[model samples]
Target: MNEIIPRYIYGFLNSGLLLIKYCRSCTVCSRLTRFPRYNDPKKLVETREGRCGEWANCFTLYCRAFGYESRLVAPYGVLTLILDFTDHVWTECYSQFLGRWMHLDPCEAIYDRPLLYEKGWNKKLNYAIAIAKDGVYDVTKRYTRKWHEVLSRRTMVTEPSLSSILTNITNETRRGFAPQLLSIIEARDIEENQQIERSLHSEDDESLSLPGRRSGNEQWRKSRSEIGSDNLSSSACPVRLCVDEHVTKIYNAFRPVLHQFIAEEVTKAEAVE
Candidate 1:
């Protein structure tokens, strides 16, 4: 007997087929109703939970069922434009072909049609960009840094990882050690004050020189500047959430079934080949 493929991969393929089958003729609400496992909005204000929950359920079930680990990630601030809420959810999957995690957002892709891409539309608020012409095929770029680096920048620390001995050595190594150390300490204090000043005046004052918030009409100027200054390669910065440990567990648990499905599909294709 031939070895069998997993069900999870078939589920993944089936999910796209299902979306195409059900969503082609149906309105968004109608398609949403079909997935009763996902919560739906009673009103516009009640949309966040429903929207987030729906994405989470589809991502988790479809991807996991296909043997891919998936998880819902919440970005830093208000991300979705559709609802007036401050958050959104997207899916992450580990791609063996890519040798790393990748992101997908079927919901955003489905919703961000050219006819639907409004200024305040929920899809427009998302940080992730879509690839499909119909905006149904989703792919996110990689752009995440280690947590320590983020903390280091926020705290004004020269090195993110400093052992006690390393700190002492650095203190003793410099010429005019005492004055240099004092100056470094003073500069940090001034920077902190400036950061606080910028935060306090950020809403009304445009002239504040802050680390991340720029003084201008451009909303993304600060983020752009940070990205440029970091000298990070494109792959280093994840545009979407990559697989972390927790998500990996979910994927691993589902992989056997998913792989079997993919294998079966591949075998069928090879038979035709």
Candidate 2:
């Protein structure tokens, strides 16, 4: 079902679903755009179109209807707010075939491309949380390869606070779950945690040559700075010059001082020789 749903959605969407780009605009002027921002899956089915959020929402509903445990994956900014094209929404279905959660983007019709945002779109995500009926999880590690850099960017909350918050949210979400279901979910979570840990240690060869953001047009993707990187190695550690910033000035000043120190040291070495 996990493998079949993406292809089905891809074909269904390509057939006739109109992707309303203006739906993302300010809702205050929604009357001007006259776009129906439908939240209900039934409404989405009737309308048959929307952005990644809608696609993920409706697709997640479909996964649940088919008895597959699913999650809505939301990649957000450091403030935990969904920023406009910088952020994206997707679905993750717990695959019975693999006994693990698999990433699925109905918009792109791609499956298991967990690094699509980080590697494919060259996005530096701060948090990629997975929200399900039973729990909320900080699944940032699943989506990013540069854990150290990601940790550096997560400045909104401390590690313990973030973990506590997520745990509280999960407990609230699972409050209504029966003991049997809760136990099953706990076991699954443990398995997934181990899987994610292993994934962090393992190198993904496919990440070397991931394609760009295929869901949006060239112009749109370029506008969002998500056109993606063909040269993964070069783009991975982008060195940006912080012109006129305090740190930049300090770095610039240090360069010549370090150069002078090296010259003097070399001269002293020559004298010794």
Candidate 3:
């Protein structure tokens, strides 16, 4: 399922099930562009608004609908491939077969392509932290090539303080959960943190990746050689027809089946889980 997921999810996001609409700027305002905000996942699942943050959150929820463990990531850093960092959101899902978290973007329909932002789009990422009902985890290496370059800027909070806050948040959020669920979450947080530690220690470059993931640098190099431009960028997503029109078709075609599935079994599945 992990190996073949790109076939289904790639088509789902890229084929237009979830659309992408640029915010005038982003979460933070620029001299030229205004700060952009987005709809919540539940609302976007129905509305299909297509903003980046909305796409990330809704996709995380969608993965959960399929019983995949997932998280919402907020990466605050440079997308300019330079010093100015901005606020952006994406998703990461645990791959049982791969034994690590893989990056996913419903906006670009990219999976495990952390370097796509930096190498493919020429961005410079400083910090990427994932937030969930379980806990928070630093997932910067999955998206950055220059940890040393950005370490000084990552001083927003100390690791100890951040960890404490995440644990408290998870506990507060899990108020109604049974002991079993709390235990499961605690184990999950530990596992995810271990992965983060490994990432921090890894000497791999953008051309290299974790055991179960593909190389974004390799993919970008291939795309450049084949297409002559970086198509992964939202502004330049390589697809036929206008992206909005293309996705509208996918949404119309898939929505009925999805709604039917939810009506029939999603509730039961959630209860069982």
Relative to the true structure, candidate 3 reaches a TM of: 0.63
lDDT (0 to 1) per candidate? 0.35, 0.68, 0.58
- The TM-score measured for candidate 2 stands at 0.69
- Tens digit of per-residue lDDT, candidate 2, span 1-273: 001111111112323443233332333443223244355654565565566777788778656654677889887642232224457889999889998999988766678988888888888878888988788898989988789999998997899999999999999988988999999989999999999988877887763666677555455677777777654235543222222154345535544543454456544334334
1-273: candidate 3 lDDT, tens digit per residue: 001111111113422342222223322442232222234454465766443566677778767766788888877542221233234578889899997788886565567876666555545566777877566666776666566776767787886886687667766788888899888777866786787667667665645422211222344335433222433345454332355466578768866756666567566375336
Model 2 ranges with Cα > 4 A deviation: 1-32, 77-85, 206-208, 229-273
Candidate 1, superposed: residue stretches over 4 Å from native = 1-49, 77-84, 110-273
Better of 1 and 3 by lDDT: 3
In angstroms, how far off is 153's CA in candidate 2? 1.2
Q: Compare the candidates by TM-score and give the number of the best one.
A: 2
Candidate 3 segments whose C-alpha is farther than 4 A from its true place: 1-38, 77-85, 205-237, 240-250, 257-273
- Cα displacement (angstroms), candidate 1, residue 167, comes to 23
Across residues 111-149, which tens digit of lDDT does each residue of candidate 1 receive? Answer: 112212111221222233221111111122122212233
Give Cα distance to truth, residue 21, candidate 3, Å.
Answer: 12
